[model samples]
Target: MKADFLKYQAQTTPHPLAMEVSYAKGSYIYDINCKKYLDFVAGVSACSLGHQHPKVVNAIKNQLDKYLHVMVYGEYAQKPAVELSKLLASHLPAPLDTTYLTNSGTEAIDGAIKLAKRVTGRSEIIAANKAYHGNTIGALSIMGFEERKQAFRPLMPDVRFIEFNHELDINQITTKTAGVVLETIQGGAGFIEPQDNYLKKVKERCDNVGALLILDEIQPGIGRTGKLFGFENYNCVPHVVVTGKGLGGGMPIGAFTASYEHMITLSDEPKLGHITTFGGHPVIAAAALATLKEITESNLIQETLEKEQLIRKHLKHPLITEIRGKGLMLAAMTPSADITNQIVLQGQEAGLILFWLLYEPKAVRITPPLTISNEEILEGCDILMSVLNKIQPTN
Candidate 1:
């Protein structure tokens, strides 16, 4: 099967680890060889409750027995989707009552961008440098990294990028700007947090310019951060908040939420402005509902801080520069990309899983499942330390 993966499957990177998986439960992924590898990446922060979470799995199975896809989004009132949306509304602040669900984070991102353009009647978009929204054309258009996007030029015209956390650049957003899209915590940019009320200041600028703030909380949403959403930590409520990643627990789902007034605008003027065949999929909605319930009702949300502290206390090495990010979403920086690469590969060889951030060369991703236990954190950190100790830094 590994040979087949190399021979037949389309590869993303030139050299893929291509580990063959058997099944996963809790915070561990079992390879076909039955080796239980401690999963620190959590499917790149997508598995909220970890692999095969009982509640999430049961919700999916129960929903399968009831119904699946009934109709397109906003047309039918499926029980799972309706209940999920209502639950989300209850958790969100006013004006963020309504939600538009999608199959993936990028789809939700695309919808949010369109909604911003439609509601504001502006064409230009302002995004933060090193911001990563998604892979789709519309989502890709606002991506701040030029090298990755240069191959797909003429993406979306009038898309401008400003340095993130640069308070002086806030003025770049003007009335002509439809929306200023940003990652509440820049994921690909080394899990960089907004410094010293930067997000609040950005919100003020957007308000002054009549521009909407569209925050992409795909990575930091669903209690990955200590708060329910990363923006809650910043004390700024955006006009639109886009979420996915861990939203579905282990399933595929995404959603963009806003006030009833702001969200309802997409229904008319250009009637049926945004439509999708499988936006509010019932099974996926059930899984997301279960995921949300588990995160909110249990002590899991509060426990993230403790887990983060445990990992930080255990991860010690001379090669490590600094640890960045909050809760389970973190990145450990090394001296160079080559050293970072060796540590990740060697750690995996020693039975621990580590990954890299999208655009951060020297940062190793450490977004383990929120469900990971204290022992698992210590074990993973030990493996990382062992690998780091073996490497000799060049003078």
Candidate 2:
């Protein structure tokens, strides 16, 4: 199976973790040998309610009994999709009421870029240094890191890069700019949060210049942070918000929301301006609706802060420099990239599941499921600490 996996499956890396999964439940994944590994990464911050959560699974099953994708997005008034959109709008601020669903976050990002261009009639899209939106061509173009994107040159043109949390960079946004896209909390940049009202300042500048502000909430949104959306914690509301990851509760989904007045332009002037056939599949929408309802109705959102404090209290060690980010979205920084690689690999053998951030080689990604128990947190940390103890800190 391992050989077949390597030969048949195209991989993101030369060496993959390649865990042959028997099954997964709650906060643990069982290997083919029935070895249980405590989960700390939560499928890279996607499975908010944990593996095969009862509500999400039940929603999918129930929706399956009814129907599947009956029509392309926006052509049908599907119950699951309609309910999900309405609930999302109710929680969002005014003018961010309409949503367009897509297959994944990258697709939603591309859609957001197009929406900005349509609305502003401008082509310049700006993003942050070390920020990662997604991997689609349009998304790849705005990516701030040049090394990863150099091979894929001649991407969407007029995309500019700026420094995240740098107040002086806000001035780059001008009338020629269509959108200023940024992560609510910069995920790939070691979970960096907006500082000193930086996001608010950016929004104000965008308002001044008539450029739209688009917040990428793929990892930090969906109750992973203490709030339903990370922007709520930052004291700013963006003109456009792109969400995915945890929103699906383990299913695949992405959505971008904006004002009805702004979104309507996409449908009429261009007729099928941005269309996705399976964007709002019934089964996926059902699962997402259940995930959103559970997060909003329960204490899970607030408990994220408590859980975050619990993790911080327990996971300290000499090799650790600092823990960056809030709520369940955290990046525990080791002294060096070599140490991070060692910790990540040894962690699995120590009976814990860990991962790494994209651009930050020194960050040990520790975003666990929001539903993880206190006992589970201790269990994972103990394993992680044991691994940390095995390696000597190199100065």
Residue 53's C-alpha lDDT in candidate 2? 93
TM-score of predicted structure 1:
0.98
TM-score, every prediction: 0.98, 0.99
Candidate 1 local lDDT, 290-363, one digit each (tens): 99999999988899999989888888777889999999999999999998899889888899999998899999
Off by over 4 Å in 1: none
The candidate that achieves the highest lDDT relative to the unseen native structure: 2
Q: Which sections of candidate 2 miss by over 4 Å?
A: none
The candidate that achieves the highest TM-score relative to the unseen native structure: 2
> How accurate locally, in lDDT, is each candidate?
0.91, 0.94
Candidate 2 Cα deviation (angstroms), residue 329 = 0.3
lDDT of 2 by residue, 1-395 (tens): 88999999999899999999999999999999999998999999999999989999999999999999789899989999999999999999998999998889999999999999999999999999998989999999988889899998889999889999999999999999999999999999899989999999999999999999999999999998899999999999999999999999999999999999999989978799999999989999999999999999999999999999999999999978999999999999999998999999999988899999999999999999999999999988888889999987676
